[model samples]
Target: MESNYHTLKRNYNQLIVITHLTQLLTYITGFGGLVVPLIIWATQKDRVEEMDAHGKSILNFQLSILIYSIISIPLILVFGLGIITLILIAILAFVMPIVNAIKASNGELPSYPLSLNFVS
Candidate 1:
């Protein structure tokens, strides 16, 4: 019973981490939100299966947005086509992560589309 309780708590903990990790931009504590999940999941790999699942989801979401920004930065100057759209995309990139965190917190495994999911 103790083991089962511990497992349940750990799973919930992972969900909590995944849910709040994206709030980093909103304030500041969420800064490591991008990396901490991976670290925790890696270190406690066998302790909670949910940790690995949520961690990879969060990691990939951040990484994909990162790649999108990298590609967009260069194209912005070269094309000069849609500055407003670009800005919105940038904002969405940041906002979506937070949204994902919120969804995860509610025990929903929200998967961002086109994410790399490198950890998996």
Candidate 2:
């Protein structure tokens, strides 16, 4: 099977930014986080060749965070702890992604805890 690869040099930077923003968006935009990146990822998927290995790593890491948040928020709500649970998740969501981006920029691929591999 063929793999989808990003092919834009600037896009690698964009992916890094998008990844960071998407993670923050889970808390800031409340749902837009999932939407924007999913759309970008879908559009950018076919051009992975444009994306450098660093870019691919960032993309995969971001994808993992995004999918995890998508699944976790609803599950956290199912617990019904009222905003607090969400707030905590949001906090983690913010922190972890930032760390990932930093690590990515430093040429390290950080494995997100409980993240599913959405970018392959």
Candidate 3:
């Protein structure tokens, strides 16, 4: 019974970590930032409420960042401001999810600044 509980806890933690880190797939698949979490959240949301919350938060952040990146493209022709904006987007995309994953692992609710509630 004790071992079973430990296994369950470990699996729960794994799911939480995966939910946050799967956004890294965006680098490979281009749209994985939203697609991966959407898939995972759809599959696991019923099994784990925490995953649902994490999924919504991640989706909101990803959507917000996507919009910001798109808006920055025009600035590239302006004063090279788009270059800096792109760099910041890349940094935020790479770092914010990891920070949120760490917080999720420790059973804390993670909040992404600049995230808009697209998923509720």
Candidate 4:
């Protein structure tokens, strides 16, 4: 007999929302914004509804922020433009997770702007 484990799924909206909010860990402990959500997604995607989509969006957004920050470092020498870019990136990084967490709570998939498709 085949096991039904693969077909089992649960509606865990709170967990999904928590996954989105975990991205803010970077602001608090200076890291784990990516690692924490990644662990939750990896371990729960098969069991939780919408975990895959939310996880992918969060990872892509975080990766994009890292890339943007790296590129901005070079721009800092060019009339200090990188400073502005970094500030905008920081704001986006700080705000989007909270907004998406609310969306997740409402059963909506995350929509992270300017996020590159790194996972899909």
Task: Write candidate 1's Cα lDDT for 4-111 as tens digits.
Answer: 997888677655555445435433653465666556657765766565677677678767766666777767788865466468655765676677776766667666
Mind giving the per-residue lDDT tens digits that candidate 2 earns over 25-77?
65666666666656665666566433244334445655665555566666756
lDDT of each: 0.64, 0.57, 0.88, 0.90
Model 4 per-residue lDDT tens digits across residues 8-82:
422488888899999999998877899999999999888787899999999999999999999999999976999
Q: After superposition, how far is residue 93 of candidate 3 from its true place, in Å?
A: 0.4
Question: Which 10-residue span in candidate 2 carries the lowest summed lDDT?
Answer: 1-10
Deviation in angstroms for 46 in model 4? 0.5
Model 4 per-residue lDDT at 31: 76
Q: Highest lDDT: which candidate?
A: 4
**1-120: candidate 3 lDDT, tens digit per residue:** 999988887798789888899988888888888898889888888887488788889989999999999999999998789999999998999899999999998888878988878888
TM per prediction: 0.67, 0.54, 0.91, 0.89
List candidate 3 segments past 4 Å from native.
Answer: none
Decide which is better by lDDT, 1 or 4.
4
Looking at model 1, residue 47 earns an lDDT score of 67
RMSD of each: 3.7, 7.3, 1.4, 4.6
Looking at model 3, the pairs that clash are: none
Residue 22 alpha-carbon offset, candidate 1, angstroms: 4.9
